[model samples]
Target: MEPFMSDLSALSSALAATAAAAAPSLVSVHSHRSRASGFVWKSDLVVTADEALADEGEVIIAFADGTTRPATIAGRDHTTDVALLRFDGRDVSSTPLARDVPPLGSLAIIVAADQGTPVAALAMVSKSAGPWRSLRGGDIDARIELDTGLRRSSEGSLVLDASGRAVGMAVRGPGRTLVIPAATIERVASKLETHGRIARGYLGAGLQPVKLDEGVGAMVMSLDKNGPAAAAGLRQGDVITALNNAPFSSMRGLMRELGPDSVGAVVDVAALRGGEPMRVALTIGERPA
Candidate 1:
């Protein structure tokens, strides 16, 4: 019991130190519709959860020094749940992204100060894997989930490694805490600030993975009404074997091939319809905003 108490005390001190180090970049985001946490991304750009800034109105950013400034939503990506705000105030120090993230099971800290002084919670990297899609179909470059439960108000807090380098941002899931990797945030934020939105190719089809002779391909379970797939004469149960000569290993792979770069471009699609192989020229459509 004494040993456990000592470990807990040491962890508390470590987390406090981390919070202090990251406090300068942390800010409280307040709006009539919502209140959450955010952090400085660049000179005058702040990043936060997209859901927190979904409300249409002005937002206030309060710093640790008690200075509040007005900010406007510069861009938002509902797919990644990331939103960038252009601040109408002085420049601020931005948090540094860790060159190499901590390995799985390494200690991490979540820092946020929605109202006053910054606070932190000790956690561990529970999952770290390859690129995947969010429940909302956001293309995440990496999978990072924390082991600790975070407060809903800490939705956009900066997640840091033990060395105090920024790793990601906290986001509340159905019943878990997910971290949007720093690399993804940096890439998405840069594009959002420049383009106001990320353009993605839309197939307008609901797909699932199906077993092929030796590999996996996407099977169209359903098609969007009057969408690109429908316009291309694709029907339900058609197994898409390849796109542009690249074998479709999974639905994710197919989606990757149909990225923003593919929007509006006509490509050859290989599929199996009713056990017969066929080809179709599909003009990819722009995903709805």
Candidate 2:
């Protein structure tokens, strides 16, 4: 039997209210710079690039009421892939956290679009939620092992959970799609509102995850203009250990500790370069766009 039209309208309104309550409100990010890369969105505290370090900038924010505000660059957290943007002491609405963020291995739905057409995908968490890559735009984020969320024209968009809560944001593309974890929003909300910046240490170098197939160590990837590794005399085939004398287990760990602020601060780097145990000093620099 056909459903009642009034009942359907009521259901839609109820669902919208529930979603409006559950989903974190989004700040539509717009760029005025001609050379700017793409549009960006902010959920008050969280940005689209909280997955992979290296996203930043100033943006104009659009509120639900048609009011607009210019957002200034606070700082970018490469390790956490979170960029902190700020307005003044003025009040602004943000996407509210509904319930708790999902645990790792839970399911989510990513929605994106090109031009104005909307698209979506279903995915499972690769891990409980660590540093994510929000710059890559593609159908699968290899690092996170999700099935959907890459779009050619969906940068600066929101990724919502099934209940209609925003789980992440859209970013750059071509390969593994990038997104921010909802939990990150929890960590940075307060800072975004107050300071408009997040403090992090810097090291000038390029790095990528390495895998040992058998015994011989090799380089998997490199960074732009020689990354922190290059500046620190780090080379390919180097087995990494600690940053700033802190024991690190993975790339994510290294990033988490790199809350760089000073451009010339010396960071302690421990790695097994060329199979020989070694230590080096890395000079951190302000991140580039």
Candidate 3:
């Protein structure tokens, strides 16, 4: 009984120490009347959940020491649900990110700030899998789900592994808690910092789904005079059946293939022109802002 009690006390103390170490980087993000959690990603940049940030409001960053500062929306990617805030006069250091995904069933700690005070939750890595795409067409590095419930104020909290290395940022998924893996944050946030928005692939043609002999296809209804589709000799009334040998029956399925990672890719487009099958090499263009 004594040994068990001692071990439990040691575990409790270690967890508390982990939370304390992350407290300095944790911050409470307030937009309009809503509040969410965030962490310092750089000296003057903070990362928070895009979904929780109001479209139009004065953003505020509250530190754990009860100090507040005005921040501006540096950039936001709705597909990835990451928003970057820029501020001045504060020198906050970011936590070190874990190089690889934590193993399944490992202990994961969520650290957040509630109005400048640190709060934490302990849970296990419920699911860890290969890369996946979000419903909004963003490519996630890895699918990491936590066995815990995230509070509204903790939407963008930093998720740490047992060793105090940051695994990712927490966000509310459809019905569960999800971690946006560290690798993804490094990739997207850097781009967001340089370009205020992510560039998506563009076809420069209006498409309408049509029933085909075997599967569905998208018929080109209109084309931009200077667009990639027009440059690739894709004419109006052409029905696109497949992209890169992958047949898609819906417009969404086709769009999903044109995520941010496909912005500069060259794809083989299989289409029907006047019932004659033809293939064209098309270099995807960036969607115009």
lDDT winner among the candidates? 3
Looking at candidate 3, what is the lDDT of residue 206?
A: 99
Where does candidate 2 stray beyond 4 Å? 2-24, 32-58, 88-92, 98-146, 152-156, 170-178, 189-289
Candidate 1 TM-score, C-alpha based: 0.75
Please identify model 3 stretches exceeding 4 Å from their true place: 273-278
User: Which TM-score value belongs to model 2?
Assistant: 0.47
Candidate 2 lDDT tens digits, 5-76: 888787567545543442223444444431111123343343544332224444655544455566665555
Q: Per-residue alpha-carbon lDDT of model 3 for 109-129, expressed as tens digits?
A: 999999889999999999999
| Clash total of candidate 1 | 0
Q: 124 in model 1: Cα distance from truth in Å?
A: 1.6
lDDT (CA) per prediction: 0.84, 0.49, 0.91
Q: For residue 275, give model 2's deviation from the true position in Å.
A: 15
Per-residue error for 194 in candidate 2, Å, reads 5.7
Error of 3 at 221 (Å): 4.0
